[model samples]
Target: MTRSEPDVRAEQEALFSTGAEHYARHRPGLPAVLFEALPAGYGRPLTAIEEARLVIDAALDAVSGIAYGVAHNDPELAERGRRTLARLRAERRAPLSPTGDAT
Candidate 1:
């Protein structure tokens, strides 16, 4: 049987609250070697579009961590991920570009 909207959302929220807590806690940092591989603009401030891209990347990572945590039978990871998303939303009030979009 098909689940109702609230049911699905509830399930999702539950999973988010539980899964990924461990993973988020011990998440590893990118190695310096990887940064050295990039062409340029490594240390400079990000441009508008670039900053937007960073935000998108962070969101994607947080979501993945949450999902992964859920799949692995962890829950707090999801809550951590949700907090990250909330923070990102709060910090991203300004437009990313002159057109007010990443594009």
Candidate 2:
């Protein structure tokens, strides 16, 4: 079943709030200079993972928009969402170069 927009938004807001609260409660008090001293590779994998996650999130958001548009009888919004999904799918199928750009 498609979820209502408000329901989905509330869930996202709650999740973000929880994450913020956790960080606030447990994050270290280390100075910025200490973080800067760490090796470059220390956070490279994390950065890559986060970048991948953002791409996935964009796809999911398009899907959610399609669902919401359909539920609300907004054909224009639904079509736009469909186009976004199609473009994303094409990008996914394209051959990637060594540097990760589609070629």
Best by TM-score: 1
Error of 2 at 98 (Å): 19
- Per-residue lDDT tens digits for candidate 1, residues 8-102, read 33233234322333334565463444333332323444455555555666677679878987898778667677777887788865655577475
Estimate TM-scores for all models.
0.50, 0.42
State the C-alpha lDDT per candidate.
Answer: 0.54, 0.50
How high is the lDDT of residue 54 in model 1?
55
Candidate 1's TM-score: 0.50
Error of 2 at 85 (Å): 1.0
> Could you tell me how far off, in angstroms, the CA of residue 18 lies in candidate 2 after the best superposition?
26
Give the alpha carbon lDDT tens digit for every residue of 1-103 in model 2: 1254532333333233333433444575634453333223233432333344444665676677689989999885576567667766776744445665546
What's the distance in Å from true for residue 96, model 1? Answer: 3.4
Pairs in steric clash, model 2: none
